[model samples]
Target: MTTITAGRLREAAELLGIRNQATLNEIRARYSERVKEWHPDVSQNDPAESHEMTIRLKEAYDLLTDYCMNRPVSFRLEDLEKDLEQSPADYWMERFGDDPIWG
Candidate 1:
């Protein structure tokens, strides 16, 4: 698992041009705007710089998304899928047993 330090969070916020207090919607908006400005296809300037900036922007968006979702910054969907697959069928049965929707 990767540790997300305050410095890393700060750097991500800076890259996205946002504050820690920014909401998920705000972060998404900023990320979209930045991506549009730096995307290689959209930007006519240095392709290398545009590519680099786009990468950084994506990283920043991912980090902030994880934080806002209360998930580890390095969390992966594959890991969750693996864990779910390993769980016994009885686990889900028990979890949803009382739900009328599952009846």
Candidate 2:
């Protein structure tokens, strides 16, 4: 199996200007916007610069897409609702649940 290092994932996210929690559609949209901006034939930048940016954008998009594709996702209503229902308190409680003070 190919290793997907955290640094590579972080670099991809940074290139696409997305947070770590972005959805697939968001990634796609961002990639499309970036490609349109830097495509060699379309950009105002010098062709070589545009080509370089386009390559970087493609690499970032591919890395994110492949990573996301391999990860599991749940789309059930209950799961969705459960995520939405989590408050700041719930998040902290989950992390510190076994501690005496936090519990």
Report the number of the highest-TM-score candidate. 2
Query: Model 2, residue 101: what's the lDDT?
Result: 84
lDDT tens digits, residue span 11-75, model 1: 99999998546878999999999999999999987999999999999998998888789955544
Clashes of 1: 0
Positional deviation of 99 in candidate 2, in angstroms? 27
When summed lDDT is taken over every stretch of 10 residues in candidate 1, the lowest stretch is 83-92
Each model's lDDT comes to 0.86, 0.90
lDDT (tens digit, per residue) of candidate 2 on 1-103: 5589899989999998896568899999999998998899989999999999999999899999999998887999999998889897888677789899867
**How does model 1 fare in lDDT?**
0.86
Candidate 2 — which pairs collide?
none
Candidate 2 Cα errors over 4 Å, as ranges = 74-81, 87-103
